[model samples]
Target: MTDDDRGTRRGEIGPTERLAMNRTGSFDWDLDTGTIDVDEAGLLVFGMGAGAFDGRPATLVQALAPEDRADLDAVIRHAIITGQTSYTAHFRVDMEDGTPQWTHVQARILRKPDGMAHRIVGIVRDTTAEVTHSDFVLELERRREVQTSIVERTTHALSRAVTVDDVTAALTGPGGLARLGADGLALGLVENGSLNLIALSGESLEILDDFRSRRLDRGLPLAEAVLSGRPRFVPAFPALGRDFPELAPYVARMRFRAACYLPLVAQARSLGGMALFYRGRTAFSADERNLALGLAAIVAQSLQRALLFDEERALATGLQETMLPRRIPEITGGEIAVRYHAAWSGRQVGGDWYDVIPLPRGRVGIVVGDVQGHDTHAAAIMGQLRIALRAYAGEGHAPSTVLARASRFLAELDTNRFATCTYAQVDLSGGTVRAVRAGHLDPLIRHTDGRVGRPKLRGGLPLGLATVFGEEEFPETRLDLVPGETLVLHTDGLVEQPGADIEAGLAALADAVRTGPPQAEALADHLSERLWERWGAEDDVALLVLRRSPDPGTPRAPRIHQYIHQADPQGLSDARAAVGQALRDWDMDDLADDAELLTGELLVNVLLHTEGGAVLTLEVLPEPVRRVRLSVQDRSSAWPRRRTPGEAATSGRGLLLLDALSSRWGVEPRGEGKAVWCEIGPVPTPAGAPST
Candidate 1:
């Protein structure tokens, strides 16, 4: 043939010759005639000599594999139908040896003037090598994606763990085996040179029970991995009978086909090892081995972190407990219960404390307080504050004086933290509470009748802050207990509900107390369960419940008592109702009006002139006179004197009215306070009252 007919310039290589050298050929397809014209090189891709191959399109279709036949034909049909400029398809052709060869067909559609396709023209190449290389690259990418996904999932699951048990549960809990793509798994933790199998998942791994605890020096594959800080992959694990005869019996009955043991190493130190078993896998590829190692690394990191966290928490909480009261001092005349809790959230150490101190004359000092933080520093400060406050109260200081000294003491500490506290001097015999606050919540009183009240105590700033603000004066509030009443004092942590109003927390606390059991210890537990347990408290809590001994009177001398606060306008009316009821209960309704009048007069006198509340007690004297004694006691030391005032004075009539309504009246000096008492009697008394 001439050089131009051979597709070449006069002096250069021909196009068809160059295409043949590159293993590429050209083709033309006629849509109307269903005919194909392939060059010699293209005939070679069809595995046939040009003389042996016909130019019919059916000839190429018959050569393609059954599954690829329709695809190759549909490529051109779709291009023509959709008006596409070109189309390319990769399909497998059946070679003479019955092997499949990947073929690439790329062609441009030629349309008539009206856009109806009539022909196609394209070059052909034998792309087996290219397609095989591309497949290898895609498989590599898929394996990489799988390995990365395994690592990400393992890391994500272990991130939330903060303890050794937490890490173990993450690795061996439900769905843990499936997440790791293992039919079974065994996890070990190194303890004192021995590996302890802390977790096991799936079946057929029960053989690991024999090695649940083995020394690192032991020749077992898992233990060796931990010692050497390497991985041991058993590709033909089922055939390990010759190498490990000890495992032969177990392997005979095992359901797994392959296994791998990976060392858990962190900071160049081996913490443990992990073993994964497969059901259908017979071997582990390099990529899979690396994936197993990566998972081990994640578990190692989490286990190490959790171990250190547990150690730190133990040390912290131990120190905290050491600083607290080892035991509460037993006291007579009343029962006292106290509870203390550390912050949850892994802190385990905080500044909350509760203390009971004995004072002179059968009185007890109770303190509940919280320092400003949730760590060792706050706990240290709390320790010092608690001891110092206890000493101050034990030395006969009043509640206000004790808290003021405590505030000053905390201000002098080495820390910059402040604290809030409530201190009270309780006298069970006198049924009195002289309480003071240093920026703490007011104490709650659960009365004998199951009603709860929050005493409105005056407060200064927090302990250290009080001195900083030049406000070290904590005013003491006097509260009357009336036998069988319970006094509750707690740190703010007990009532601090996140995102809720402090007032709402206080209301909930009141409701809990009103509904809880009446005993001191039971009520303390109830409050702890209701508030601290329910909240999973993020801050430390300290609670104290002190219930006075009951004073049930004899049948002949029935008595009733009530506390009246000057701020409680309703308390004044309630006090009057209680007194009348008591008198009637004693079958002396004849004296109810007079006893109530005396109670009102004396209670009004105390509420009006005193700085705090008063306690009123009415009891029948067992003497034959059938006399009813009414007494009003207040923390105020001022005794009432019978005073006469002008009719229009509108004041100073309390004592004068008490004198006119009662048979006799007197004033007695009590410890830290005074009592104004009166007696009401009857000449025409009922039944056994006066038999002559």
Candidate 2:
């Protein structure tokens, strides 16, 4: 070809020849001559020898394999007619040795001055190795992507496993073992230094269940795997019976031939081991082993977290139960019913508590309070605050003062949390209730006529808020509980559901109170069940119901009465026996020891000081408030007085001892003698005004 015909081509001028010479091979085509010229390397790519054939377009076309010749010719013809700048083709070529390999040809069309194709310059190379290597890399990349997906799904599924059953389900269920290329799984946990099977799945499940309640000894393969904190694999697991004859029975039932035992270890602690099984012999690959180890680790972490959460939840529930009052005391004029519901989803214990403290003068102090959080911290704070409120109320503080003291108590702890509380004192005899609020929901009042409404009460800031800013004031709201009226006190959890309007919850609560059963116990149960069904508690709920009891037709005598003769030391013993019996009759055996001691002291005082006979009386008053009153009436008019006796002096310390043992004591003038009476109970305010 002439230099003008080949070198003057526009698209394939500079660097084309140099590039082709160094890497592939170059070819020059003269459209006018209708022939092509191939370099030495280009001839090798096409399996041709020098001068073996003329470089005609038809001859070059014959070199391409049959399947590629037509398409390559079509492109060359299009390039010549349209003046296309570049064209590329990949096809198979036959070598002289009868071997087939892939070849790639890239060519540029050289246009003449009139925009017509003058010549073609091209580069050619055998790309069989590159294509094969690219396909291999693509396969490896796809497999890696699949493995990553499996890991992500395994972790995601295990994340919500809160129990052994949940973990087992995630492991062998649809996407778990199958995705990980396993057919079955067994999970064994270390309990009391022994490996115990707690969960099993898949076709090999029966083999694991055979030892479900039994501990695997050190000789067992599973136990050894966990103890060593290493992975173990068996291509034919059924053959294990030959080494350990004791496992022959379980091996006979196993459906899987291959198995892998991976330790479930976290933070250097071996919590358990996971067993993966396959129906056919599996020579475990590195990727398979790695996936098993990773899955085991994830399972260990999830299981450990769930177990700790359950432990904490159980502890919190126990504490809450222990902190709550065991039973509601039967008051003289009213009955108290209480219900406590913890959140169903989380910690199971929350910061809601209710208490009924019997005040002086036949009055009952009712309290409902809620701390800020739903965790153990909040429950602990609730406990402390509940006890403090009870102590303050028992000291005979008014509703307002009691709450004020409680607020200060919580604020002083510096826990950075707040509480809302309501404290109410119900005088059953007077049918009056005085209540004070500390940023708490209003109390619901149900009238005797079946009408219910929330009582409007002025409230101060929540407990810790005022202390952070300044002093706080609690306002009181007083109302009379008519004959059949009942008061409902509760934490906000009862009336405030998640994302619902507070007013709506309040109205619903009021409606439930009005339409529920009339009796305190039944009404309390009804409201609890209904409210919980309507709106599951996301927080803790504390509900207290106090209702006036119907008047009894006749008055009942004191629980115990006795007459003691002069010079009768047996009277003291008899008095103690009576107190014990009375306490037992009240189902209060827990108080027998204290009651007996106090009764003995009073009777001894009567026997030591008085010469004449005395009347002993023990009575439990459940109206207006609940209290156990013991009185000693003697013919002697001498009244008993409290005195600070010397430590060594025992004779003059009876009254002093009585004053310390009893909640309150006084001397009263009777028709024929003087009566010394003392009260022991949750009876209101030991420091406030005495009973009228």
Candidate 3:
């Protein structure tokens, strides 16, 4: 090489060599001659014999593995041609023993004074162990961070899951298995000590479905995990051929060589197992195993909680249904409809009941009551109270008498819970109603024209507080139901919301009832839906509606109509029943006993003094004159006559008894028979009746 080409910078090569002498190796390359000179350590790093390498650039390049030779040569040529300051590269070289060793090379060009390319001076170091260790650590850290994030997100999802299906989706959905690097997932719950596959993801579903149908016991990774309460890891699919040869096709189709079965254990109890699949054999790290175990624990706990809630809610629903009446009494002259809405709190039962009892003499008893509690105990008490009320009312007691007796019955039981109730007796024939309240909301009356009114009732103490006394009796309120008017009785749950004005809810309820559909059924349904949509009160609600419409032939709302036959002495009984029914329909059930007596007297006179069967007809006069007219016709020309009974004269005093019991009595002679008629009063003096 020429002097200038030798380079003044190259004169300091001795100092550069001394600096690169320890640990690392040093080398010099003449670009013009394409010759290389390496120290002993440099030759060792390049995988060349101590004195075997000639001073040739090709020889040095040939020592490096083929994969790295071209890139290293290009870097060296560029540095020399452009007089680049420095360049570094890592490459591999094959040792004499055929073992590959990794090396790092750093080169700097020694330029001439004219700034032309001259010689290249460089150092070489063996970094095979350090590079391999660093890459392995970095990869492990990346995997750990990824798995930690996935586990955290999965736990959050599981926490929000409130049902079994939600739990399954969180464990096997796209957000779950994919993040965990699983190819397919199968979740098997340990129910009744058996592993039953409930959810699956990816291609494993078909295989898992077949496996579940087989009902195999033992020899399965999932079963083993659940039975042992530990995780089972299968490193390779072929390794399972001996134990589970049936899974070969599944493994092949899913391209699965590795799998993990983890038991979902919580509080030391094994609830289920989770199966994870991978495309190739995987050596699970301790971190991965621990992460999976934690995930299983969270899933197990969430599933257990959701399952328990479902069971409790079902039980509560059953109890509540049994406590409420299934059907209302089918009566005439009016229509009765009932509705019940349950509380929203899970597994919590409320004490709300509605009943319709058809009593003797055609009087109907309607009750809406609420027992204080939010559990099974309340439901039980409500059922008992409902039965007691029905029994008392059916025994021919008046509305106030029935409620007072019910209150006494509750007090005798000494149950800590109290109850509010409203009892109403509707007289279909009399067109009158009597209601008594025991610490309950007053009944609402909705007129056909959309006006609503609630009477100012005096409330008594709630049942279970004390025995009913003369002064403490539930105060009675009487109403003359106008045609097309409805009486609404509801439990407090319908109008009471938590931390809100109760009066507002009551006004809303009254408005809904007044403006609802005219038909009883449609009105009841509409009011219930309105309550649910407006406040969604979390308490149970019970509504009972009784509507009295205009005359039957006018095409108004639904009403009841019944007929009975009259024959001999049975005819007298039938006559009483017919009048009683009419009286009850008219809401004058209080006058049923007297009316029945008058009808019985007339029917008996026909059966005893006349020759043929009698036909009894009972009818009601609406609004302006609320009266029940009872008439019995017999095929006899003899008309009834008033006679003064001689104490022992049971046969001749029929007309006298009818005259004394009824507001009006008369006998009209027909062509073939004589008709005896008696009429009961238009109850509640006209001056006392509410204005339309």
Clash totals in order: 0, 11, 16
Ordered by TM-score, highest first, the candidates read 1, 2, 3
Give candidate 1's TM-score.
Answer: 0.74
Candidate 2 yields a Cα-based lDDT of: 0.77
TM per model? Answer: 0.74, 0.54, 0.53
Write the residue-wise lDDT of candidate 2 on 38-81 in tens digits: 88778767777677757766765575667689887787788677
Deviating ranges (above 4 Å) for candidate 2: 1-82, 92-100, 108-124, 150-184, 197-207, 218-221, 235-258, 277-281, 327-351, 356-366, 371-419, 423-436, 443-455, 458-489, 492-692
Between prediction 1 and prediction 2, the one with superior lDDT is 1
Superposed model 3: Cα runs more than 4 Å off: 1-145, 160-186, 190-216, 219-221, 234-259, 276-283, 311-349, 361-363, 375-377, 426-436, 441-458, 466-692
What lDDT would each prediction earn against the true structure? Answer: 0.81, 0.77, 0.74
Worst 10 contiguous positions by lDDT, candidate 2: 550-559
- Residue 478 Cα positional deviation in candidate 3, in Å, after optimal superposition: 6.0
- Candidate 2, after superposition: displacement of residue 621 in Å? 23
Give lDDT tens digits, candidate 1, residues 1-692: 87656545456777777878777888998888989898899887777788887798778657876667777767767778899989998877778888767777788998899999899999888888898899999999997887777777778788988789888888788767766888988888889988899998888677668878777664677887888877988888878666667667777787888889899999988888898989889988877987888888888889889989888877877888888899998888799999877665565588889899989988888888888888778888888898999999999987888888888898887568999988888887666678888888888888776768776677788998988889989887676666688899988888886787878778889999999999999998898888885553677788899998887665555678776778998998899989898767767788888777777777788888889998778766655665787888777777776667897888788777766788888876553477788887753455654342
